[model samples]
Target: MLVSLTREKFEQIIPLIATGAQYAYYWGKWQDLLNRLLISVVAVVVILILDVVLGQGAQALILLLGVIAGLYWLWSPIYWASLRNNQYRRFPYSGFWRGRILEIFLTEDLIGEEETVNQRGDLVINEIRERRINLVIGDETGFEIELQAPLQRLYKAIAPGQIAELLVLSRQPNLAKIDKFTDAYIPSLNLWIGEYPYLQRDVFAEVSRQLGSDRSRANLNKNRVRKPPMK
Candidate 1:
């Protein structure tokens, strides 16, 4: 199921959108922009109020806090893009793979420890757990791997036995040596199940369509082979 994917092929298949559009999409819509702007404005106003009320003694500290907020608002987009570029750096060599989801189930997972105040006002650390869906996928060769993802709205539609697609990466150009893997794309559900969104949605869809056609043809050939000749 795994097919060789060179860097040239990867770049062609996984195209990145324009920087402006990508930033807007990843950073969110007008609501997010307003929230960030509002926080920066609030911090500046608070700093001014502190300077007037608390006098010059605390001006340095107050201004520093305001500057930090402003800086975060200004540099957030660049910081986000830097994080997004990680996929390119991590997977120098990769391959496309198609498989079938063999199993699907939910499992409770410990997320973190949260501090809560009890009725008596005693603070206690409590374990936070959430149910997450886990999927097991395999190829016709019997090579199976488990892919775990947080339950999202689209994931509810995914069932066992549906086709699953993913990009398998390797340190070397060897398909057998699977060094790492990108998130799994469930074409049937039009959903990607993973912690991070590695692939561009439009480009991923294009690649999936090509693979789907190939799969259809393969099935047709198999069916033809299975049919008995006329007596």
Candidate 2:
């Protein structure tokens, strides 16, 4: 199920690049939002105290804090956009691969750890766990991969036997070796599952639809050609 991506076809994805970038802008590193807020609050209080006592040096340090905050918030969108284009150039050749959903379930994964005190007032790092969607997908070649995604309405409806389209990376023009992969796109749900926003959903949907239709036609033709009786 490796469909080649041509230059002309790839160009269609250009118009939709901004969509992915925008998505990255808003939702990127969302898990760290609380920590960022706490840090900013603490930094502001420190700067205010220092400014009153040591005006000149505090002003310079305060300016640096602003720069750091801006970078932290903006790096996701900027980096993702650049990487998207770089991937296209570096891997000029591309292919489309898909797998069948063998199983779908939910699991609570340890997402982070935070320092906290217990009833006895002891300092300890507490585990932060969150429910995530887990998937087991198998390709026609019998290669299976396990993937996890944030639990959302988009992933809740996944069922066995549905197709799981994957975005894999490889240097070979034919995708001879799929050593790394990015995300899983479920055409049936019109949703993507992964930690990163990597695809232009519109283009992915269009391409998936076309591929689905083409495969259906091919399968129909194959079925029409009856096999001869075994001697």
Candidate 3:
């Protein structure tokens, strides 16, 4: 009888749970694009060869198939790469769009190290720190906005166990840039929201048995605790 209720509970909160998982998954995915790039390149070449071998009449069809596959493989890494590299292509934020809804987790509790900054001319930009920021989000992609901005001050002042909420703006992307910080990107499911609450090494081990979020099931299992998992 308890099992039935447990399943029901999982179902009821599945949306939120899925959101957390997605964030966790994509966050890593954004970093995995490098490994996948070579594969994507090979796939494109193979598709082109097959299209030519099949015949000219089917050239358009094969080309279409190749393009679709190429796009599917490239979108995430491309998007993340573009965003990370482009200073102007900042993550979309509430001020940029309106009416869009989102959930935010205050991971200040999971603080790592303080980020340093240098004044270049007059702009205040981060000087690349050794800490990892755990910012997760759940979004209905169809909404007008493309990039959802991080809650800046809150993220800066995050503490353990702090959770918050915010509304996002509605806007469409006219152009986007690649991120230079990361080397690759991957795609993820929509269940990372709840998973993150336990991803902290201290928290993960303590609640592993309770949440079934053990290393065996984690999408990110390389890290043991303080150190980052292999990138």
Candidate 4:
């Protein structure tokens, strides 16, 4: 069936998106190490094959390849280490994979309903059913982060107050700060609502339809606007 969606319906499933920096922080470590190891291993295997194909110059070729591979092996870890170190300094409360710092909780300790206006002109309301923790970078975007499961070691580096400061980057956009929220699993972070949008699809759709098509179109048009000309 070709399902058609009302604008309201589409907004309901607007999946939360993560920022690129957080994305890199979450998955970069293991992938970087694996890639470096793969490159070094492949270089060695290729050198061995070259040695077999050209018997006389095989050893010399292997030696040269070995030198290059050794250089890569030495440099890759240092490079990766430096990059990770820098990222940690910027987002100490954020999670990482390569190092011993296990998990960083972004949100903590809140109950009941929460609402805040977002930068994108959308209102976000989070109903804190229970104590829950979601990692987030300190930015106006209020982007939420998800870390790899099975977090081993916990970092006691950045205090809870510091993380709160990063998330509330600006005073504008009607950001709502919820205090005393606690997450049992990860009890270090604070909970804040940056922006969450609500839709009429859930219970209002039927009611709005009864009101008439004119009302429906008006509701739909309110949320949509004409795009500006590219030229």
Candidate 5:
């Protein structure tokens, strides 16, 4: 069954979801900071080498810049972490809901690739493929939610027309976070099938086990309906 929330319920849950989103936002920022720090370190090293070779007398200037960058690099994560902790303190409850994917699409965007040194000190060329995703989700009550997310793990796992469960911070409507796809009934096959390929075996096993029970056997035989297996 599709799990939904009313506006009152939605208001209550928004903060929970917002906390999750806030953390995710800060995490992305942290990553960007780390990348920038790495680049700054490399630049500092290059500048020092140039100073030594060219005798440019700019070593002090380069060193100062490096120190400032390093300080900011160390401070950024701590600042964001504290902020996240403070916000999450207000929304401590967690809950889940079931919804169906109504639509899914992506828009491609170019991102600058960063150069990194591996353990062996060799430069690794990384190409960034950034994409923005738009997902339209509908609950059993016909309430639709539209989300824009980075093309990341959860976004890649789900598709249009699939049923999914989301974990949200309780009392926070805006914080609906994708948990996983759920098995759905296939009227054509008279069987339950997983929305995701990796979950097929587990879903099948659970459903078969449920049908095997004497209590559920009769119900299974009568209507042959299946519910999404709990994780």
Candidate 6:
């Protein structure tokens, strides 16, 4: 069920899935920058307090620890930002690959938390949901690929055993973006259903309708089963 697509056609589909609102990109770079900045500020305050309490003898030790911590906090953000920028710039020039989806699953994670006080003076935990999709796809030649995508409604529309295409960056295969997907297989009908863009919102509604119809037909056939006359 693999459909080979030209680079031009693949680029056209890239925008549908390659959105800027990915959870990984946000947590990996932006949130990371803020976290490091906060840690560095706290470290500096601690070092100053230690210097005053321990006097000149411990000043050298305190300075050494502070320097190491400062370098660590300062380096991460710079490296991450540059790497992220380069990835985005190279996406348009990446190669494309197509495969049939063997399996798909969604995962939800609590990446961070916010604290709040309730009316009764109780502490509340506000958890952030980070959703992602894991997909296993295989090509005609039997090569299989495993991919994970950040939170997107498109993942819900896709079902197991559907044909899908992906855009693969030569150096960064893990960041491969989903390009398109076909409808699920109907067992009784023995057919592959409609094709839709990966980002289409109406796909879920259409899939629900098709599934409802199939369920009704299956129940009707089961009720039609005749029992033999028994003693």
> Tell me, what's the RMSD of every candidate?
6.8, 6.6, 21.7, 22.0, 14.2, 16.8
lDDT of 3 at 176: 32
Q: Identify the candidate with maximal lDDT.
A: 1
Top TM-score prediction, candidate number: 1
Query: How does candidate 1 fare on TM-score?
Result: 0.68
Clashes of each: 0, 0, 40, 8, 11, 0
lDDT of 4 by residue, 96-203 (tens): 101112234644444468788889979999776443434432333443333222222343333333333111111222223221111112213322122221111222
Q: What are the lDDT scores of the predictions, listed in order?
A: 0.75, 0.70, 0.35, 0.39, 0.51, 0.54
Error of 1 at 170 (Å): 0.9
Summarize candidate 6's per-residue lDDT along 25-88 as a digit string, tens digits. 3335666767877887888788888889888998779989788666656555444544544443
Tens digit of per-residue lDDT, candidate 5, span 30-147: 5687786786677667766766875657768767766765565555544565554435334434333446679877877656787999999999988887777766778777766565
For residue 100, model 1's alpha carbon misses the true position, in angstroms, by: 0.2
Alpha-carbon TM-score of each model against the true structure: 0.68, 0.67, 0.28, 0.25, 0.36, 0.36
| TM-score, cand. 5 vs. native | 0.36
Q: Write the per-residue lDDT of candidate 1 for residues 195-222, one digit (tens) a residue.
A: 5555566666777798778889998988
RMSD of 3: 21.7
Comparison by TM-score, 1 against 3, better one = 1
Error of 6 at 127 (Å): 3.8
Candidate 3 deviant stretches above 4 angstroms = 1-9, 15-31, 74-231
Candidate 6: give the clashing pairs: none
